[model samples]
Target chain A: MGIQNKYYGWRWGEEDPIFKNLGYIQNVLGYIDPADKSFTSNNFKELFYPGDFDLLQKSWKKYKKGTDHAFEMSYRFKHKDGSWRWIKESGLANVFNTSNNPIGGIGTIQEVTDKKKKYTQLKSILKNVSIIILRLRQDSNNQITVDHISKEALKYWNIPCETLLKDEGYLRNLAHKDDLVGIRSALSNSFAKMEFFECRWRVVSKEGNINWCQGVGTPLKDKDGTCFLDIVITDITKEKLYTEQLKVSEEKYHSLFQHSPQPSWVYDLETLAFLNVNSAAISKYGYSKDEFMGMTLADIRPECELENLEIQVQKTRENYLNFFDGYFKHINKQGEILTVHLYSSPITYNGQKCRQIIAIDISEKMKYLKFIENQNKSLKRIGWMQSHELRAPLVRLMGLINLLTDQDSIGKEERHYINTEIINSANEMDIMTKNIAQIINDAQLKEKMNDVQIIAG
Target chain B: MTYRLLQVDDDPVILFLHNKLFSKYTNSKIEQFKNGRLALDYILIDNGPDISYLLLLDINMPVMNGWEFMDEICNHGLENSTSVIILTSSADCTDLDKSKSFANIVHFIQKPLTKEKIEKLPLLMEYLALQD
Candidate 1:
C-alpha cells in the first residue's frame, strides 16, 4: 500500500484522488506534522489563517492522548479575497515515528463560513429582541430546569442570563410574590398535560420596577419522561395601563350621567330613539327608564308640535357641533302639556351619533306669565273705573253739594229736588264701588286658580 | 253770528249745574243732553249753518262718549262748526292726551261745570262777548 494507504485507505498529498477532484470533495486534504506542530497541505501556506495554532495543537494532543477517538477541530482559514473563513477538520491519526509517537495525520477540511454566519445572526437577533424566549425542561421526578434563556431577559428583569440558566429559581424569583404560586402552577399544568402554556404575571425587577408580562408557548413531552416548554414572554405594561385608564374614564362618565339632577337624555339622531335617560328624566316625564328606552323624541312632544320637532331634529343633524337652545311643548305620560326649554349638545355615544338634552320644565313659568298679563288687564279696568265711572257719580254729588252750599235760603221744592238728586248720585256711587271691587276679586280668584293648576300639573 | 252752548253728560245733575252756570254768566241759551249721542243729534238736526255751537263734552257716557262724539263731529265735516271743551271727571292724563288728537276739541276741563270754569273757556267767552 502507499504511504497514504498506510495512514488511512487513500494516498494523500499529490496522489490523493479526493483532493485532486475538487468538484467532488471541495475540501482540503492535509497532513499534520505532530513533531513540528504544523499543518501541511496542497495550499497550506496560503490558506491557513495563523491565529488558532494553539487551539489546533491542544485538540491534536487530546486525540493523541486517547482523550478523543478522532482528531477533530474547527478553525479560521484565509479565503481567496483575504477574508477569514471557518474550516471544520476531521481525520484519523494512523502514522507514528520510530519511538511510537504519532508523527502524521490525514484530515479533510471543509469551509463552514455560511453556517457560522447564519448562527451568528440568529444569536444577535435573540440577544437584542424585546421578547424573551425561554426553554424549560421537567423530568419525571418533577425537577424543573431552564434549558435555555435568551439574554433579553437581563434587560427587563435586571438578572444575568447565566444566573437564570444555571438556577431556574432566579427567573422564577423575579415574579411578584403574589404571582409566584400562579407561575409555578402554570408550569406544572403545561408539563402534566403537554398542552399550550399561557399566563400573564407581574415581574418585579431587582431595581423595584414592576412590569406586566404575558407568556405564551407550547409544551412537548419526550419519550424519556421529560417535558419541554418553549415560551415567548412580552412586556404588556403599556397595554394594561391604557385599558385600566379607559375603564376608569368610562366609569366616571357613567356616574355623572346616572346621578345628574337635571332631566337629561341621549337620543339617536337618525331614528330619534331615546338611547339613555337619567334619573331626573325618568321621574319628571312620569315614565320608567325602560319605557323611555322604547320611546322616541316625538313621543314626548304634543301632536300639535310634531312638525316643529321634526324640523328641529333636521336642523340638529345638519349642525351637529352647534349648541342648541330652543323651546318645545312636551306632553308627559299623564297627558299634561309641559313647556320645556331644551338645551342640547351633540356627542358620540356608544358609537352612535347622538344628542344629549337637558329639559327644563318651564310650564309653571309660562302659566305665571299669563296670569300676570291677565292681572294687568284687570288692574287697568279697575283704574279706569276709578278715574271715570266711579268718579262720574262723585262729580255729580260734588256739583249738587256746591249748589246746596251756595244758597243762603232755599224753597221747599228746590230743597227736595237737590236732596233727591244727591240720593240718586250716592246710589250710583255705591254701585260703581261694588263694580270695582268685583273686578279685583275676579282677578285675584283667577290668579289663585292658575297657581293651583301649576302645582298640580 | 249766532252762538250756542251745549252741555253733554250722563249725569243729570252735572247738566243741571251747567245750565244754571251758563244761564247766569252768558247770553246764549244752554242746551242739555244726557249723553253724547243726544248732544250730537241735537247739533246735527237743529244747528244752523251760521250758528257755531260750543259743546262741553263729558267722557264715560252710557251710549256715546266724548271721544266718540268728536269722531262723529270730525267725520261729518262739522269740525269747523263745532268747538268742544272736554268736560270729564277723569283725572287721568291719558284722557287729556287723547283729547288733543281731535281737531274739533278746543281745551280739556276737569268736571263739575262751575261758573268760573265756563267763563274761562275761550269758545264760551265768544258767546259771552256776544252778550256784551
Candidate 2:
C-alpha cells in the first residue's frame, strides 16, 4: 500500500498513526491506525523493509502451517534527533485468525549500538588479562586443573592449551614427585580449614627442565558444599636456590660450633654468666652441663683472686680495656687447682653482652721455670768463684816472678839456675790456672752438650 | 851501719828463709820472732833501742796473726823504731783485700820467697830511707 493512501484511509487499522508525515514515513517507521485493523499494502512500506517484510511474510505462512515462527533482524532507523540508530527487531508471528487464516505479527525493536560497543571493550580487557594471569582449579577429588591460564603460563609450560588442558594429570605431572605428597597434604589441610595456603614445589615442564613454583591457593565452595581450589603460581627458582644456600651456610656454622678444637665459651659479660659453652670447654673445665650452667665466671676463679678479677672485669665493661690475658687459678670440680693462662675478649653475642675466654693450663710450665731459676743461681755462684778467689793466686805468683827477674848482680850460672826455677814455678802456676779454667769450661760445655743431645733426640 | 831486722813467721822454713834472705840480701842485723805476740812484747819494751830497725810480719800464722799484732801494737800506740812489711804464703783475695785496711803494712808478698824478691828490697830500703 502507498503511504499516503494508507494514512488517508486508515479507519480500519488497530490504532491511529501518531506520526503520518511523508518525510517522517520516509525516514522513520511510524505507527498505523487502529480502526484499519489489518495490514494493507500502503502501510506495509512504512511498517517494515522489503527484506524484513518478505521474511515476516514467509514466517507467517510457515506459522499457519504449524511451523516455528519466532525470528529476529536488524536495520538502521532515523531517531527524533535525526541520527541513524542500529535497531534489532525480534518478533513472534501469529497467523491464526478467528477462521485460522494467516494475518499479522508483533515484534520488539532494541537499539543495540551501546551494547555492542561495551561487549567489544570487555573482550579486549579479558584478552589483556589473560596474558599475565594463571588460574588453576581443583575438584572435590583434589584433581588440579588449569581453568583459565594466562598466555604467559602457556609459554612457561612451553605447550599449547589443547595438549595441556586435555590431560587431567597435567598439574600433578608438573609437580616434582618428591614434593607431590607434601603439596597435596598442604592443599588438603588448607581446604579442610577453609584457609588460604602458600607452598613451594618443583615443577617439571614439558621441556624436561625443573622449575620451582610458589603457589598461593584459596578454596571456593559452592552452595552445595562442593569445594574447589583456585590457585595462582609464580616461578620461584631463584628464591628457592637462595634459600638452599642459606640452609647450607647455617649447617656449616652449626658444624663449626659443635666441633671446634679450642675450648670456646660464650657468656654474658655484664653478669659474668655463661650462655653457651662448647664440648671442649665442658670437658676441660671438668664440669657437667648442669653444673657448669649453675656456676659463673667468679666461681671458676680462685677465691683469693676473685676480688682482683672483679676489678679487671669492671674495667673491661667500662671500655678501659678490651682484652686481657693472665694467670688464673681455676679449681676443678674435684677441688684441684689448675693454673690456667686465661685470655678473654669482649664481643656482642646474640643481642646480649658477652665475653669469650680461652684458657690453657700452665702449671707444668711454672714448675719447669722454677727448676731453671735454681740452676741459674748455682751457675752464677760458680762464675763468682772463678773470677775472684781463683784469680788472686795467679796474680801473686806472677808478681813474685817479676821481682825475681828484675834482680841485677848475680853470677851467670846462678842466674840461670834461678831463671830455671822461676820458669818451673811459672809453669806450675800456669798448670794450676789451666786446671781451674778447664773445670769451669767443662761444666758449661757439659750443660750445652746435654741440651743439644736432648734436641736431637 | 846495720840495723836489727825482726822476721816473724809460723813456718820454720819461711822464717829461716826470711832471715837468710834479708841478711844475705841486705846489710842489716837480724832478730827472729816466731809468734806475733812475742814480737809485740819484745818491741813494746821501755829500753828498746832507738836504732833503725825493721819488722817482717807474717799473716795466717798459728799462734798470733799479723793483723792481730798490728792491731795490738797500734792500740798500744807504741812509739816503735821499726818499719813493718807483711810477709805471707797466703794468696787469698780476702787476705789481699784485708791488707788495704792497715796503714802500717808496707807490702803484701806471696809465699816461696826467692833471692830476686829479696833483692827487690832495695826499693823498700830506699823507701825506708826516705821515711827516716
Candidate 3:
C-alpha cells in the first residue's frame, strides 16, 4: 500500500501525523482502488449520492483510459450527518503497472454547498428583476471591460451576454450620438470622485428601436484592488413620453389663454385673488398685470354692486365645481360703469382650486337697446299725432268742401260763409302738414345721426 | 220729459259742422259749446230729472276732455240720463278702446260729423224720435 501510494505520489498515509493533523484534508480525502475493479468497497457506493452517479462514472471512465491528466468535477456527496452537499472533486490518476494500466487514484474534495446556494439565489434574483445589471471593471492599465451582465441585458438590448463581455465597445456604441459626450463625462466624473453615478440617456437596440434609459451606479473596488461599477439601467421610456406630452399640452393651453380676444383671468377660489390675467384683460380693465395681481374681484365692482358681489362669491365658494354665467355691472380704471357679460368655470390652476373668467364688454349693446326703446316711444308719439292732430284739419277741409258741393238750399250769405270756412280749413291743414313734416324730418335726422355713431363706434 | 242735443268741441269749425249736420238730420234744436268745460257747466246748471241730454263729445279738448266730462257725468249720477257719442278726427284704435271703458259713451265716430256717420247713431235717432 505504501509503495502504491508512493507511486501515485500521495505519500501521506492514513496514520501520517501531518495528514491526521490536517483534519480538513482528512475529511475530504477520497480514493478509488484499481484492485477492487468495481470500486464499491470502503462505503464508496453508500457515500456517493445517486443523483451524481453519472458524473462519477464519466470521470472514472477517463481514468480507466489511462490518461495521465488531472480532472475536476462537481457533484453531490452524502455527508456523515445524512445531508447532501455539493462537492468539488479534483483528482489525478498517476499509479500505473508495468503494462501501463492505472492501479489507483487520489483526489481532494471541497464542500461548496453554501457557495452553490448563494450563486443560485443570485441568478434567480437577476432573472426576476426587470432592470439590467452590468458589472464593469477597470484594470490598472485604464482599460475597461464588461465583466458580467445579467440575463435581462440580453433580453432588453437584444444582444448576447457573451458578445457584450467580449466586445466592450458594443454597449457603448449603442448610446445615441447626442448623448455620447454626456455619458463619457458622467462616467469619468464618477471614476474620479469614486461617487454615485447617474445618467439619463437614449440607447438604440440591435432591433433599431430607441429606448430612453436611466443608469444609476455605485463605484466599488473588488478584493483584487480593481475598480468596478455596478450599474442598474432602468427603462424610462413611458415616463419620458408622458412628461413630454404634458409639456406640449401645457404650452398649447398657455398660448390660447394669452392671445384670446376677450378679457380673461384666473383667480384663486379661497383667497379671491387674481392668479393670472390675460393680455386682453390687461388692456380692457386698464390695469397692468402686476396691478391686477394685487387686487381681488371686488376691486372691479361698483360701490352699489359690492353687496351683490359678496353674495355671488359666497355662492361660488359653496359650488366651486359649477359653471357660472351672469351679467354684472363693473367699474373700470376710468370710473366708467360698464355692463360685462361674464363666463366662469372651475379648474385646477397651479395646484390650487381656482376659477377662470372671461368677460365680454356689453355696455355698448345696452346703450343700443336704450336707444331702440326711446325711438319706439318717439314713433308711438308721432303715430298719435298723425292720427289725431294732423287728420283733424284735413277732415275739416273735406267736410267744408262737401258742404259747398252738396248743400244747394243755402242762401248767398251762407254760401259766402261756407267759402270762407273752406279757405280757412285749407290754410289750417297746410300749416299743420308743414309742422308734422318738420317733426318727421327732425326724427329722421336723429336716426341718421345714431346710425353714423354706431358705424363709427 | 225734455230732450236736448249738445255739441262739445275745442275747434270752432267742428262745432259749426255739428250744428249744420244736426240741423239737416233732425228738427230738434242743438246747442254748441267751445269745450267740454262749457258744456259740462251748462249741463250742471240746466239738467233736470225730467230732462234727458245726448252729448256729441270731442276727445282732444282743453279743460275737461271727453273722458273727464264722462267721469264727471258718472260722479253726478247723470250717466243714465246723459248718453254721449264721441265725435273727433281721431282714427286711433286706442281711443276707440278707451271709449269702451266709459259706460255713457255709446258711439265712437271719426269726424267732421258726416251725414252717414250721424245717421248711424241709434241714440240720436231715438232722441229725435223722442223729440217728436
What TM-score against the true fold does each predicted structure earn? 0.59, 0.44, 0.61
User: Compared with the true structure, what per-residue lDDT tens digits does model 1 show for residues A71-140?
Assistant: 6677776643456767566776466668766545566655567778887887788667668888889877
lDDT of 2 by residue, A1-457 (tens): 1222121222213332222323333433433444533344465344543365456446534444664555555554443444544445455555455875434545554556466667567656645432224455656676656666555444655443454556765556658788988887887788778789888888776677887887786878867566766666777787788989978976895577567765667778777887877787777778887777777888777798899878878887887337888887887776768788888887667777678777776765665565466557656655555553443344444444544555663456645655565565567567766776766676677567656754763
* Candidate 3 global TM-score: 0.61
Instruction: Say which docking band candidate 2 falls in.
Output: incorrect
Report the C-alpha displacement of residue A67, candidate 2, in angstroms.
23
Fraction of the reference Cα-Cα interface contacts (below 8 Å) that each candidate reproduces: 0.77, 0.00, 0.74
For model 3 the local lDDT of residue A390 reads 80
Please give the TM-score that candidate 1 achieves against the real structure: 0.59
Task: Name the regions of candidate 3 deviating beyond 4 angstroms.
Answer: A1-162, A170-174, A194-198, A205-207, A216-234, A298-305, A331-337, A409-457, B1-132
lDDT of 3 at A91: 62
Where in model 1 is the C-alpha error above 4 Å? A1-167, A170-175, A181-249, A261-263, A280-292, A295-309, A325-341, A360-373, A408-421, A443-457, B1-88, B91-132
Question: Of models 1 and 2, which has the larger lDDT?
Answer: 1
lDDT of each: 0.76, 0.62, 0.76
Report the error of model 2 at residue A12, Å: 33
Place model 3 in a CAPRI quality band: medium
Which candidate, 1 or 2, has the higher DockQ? 1
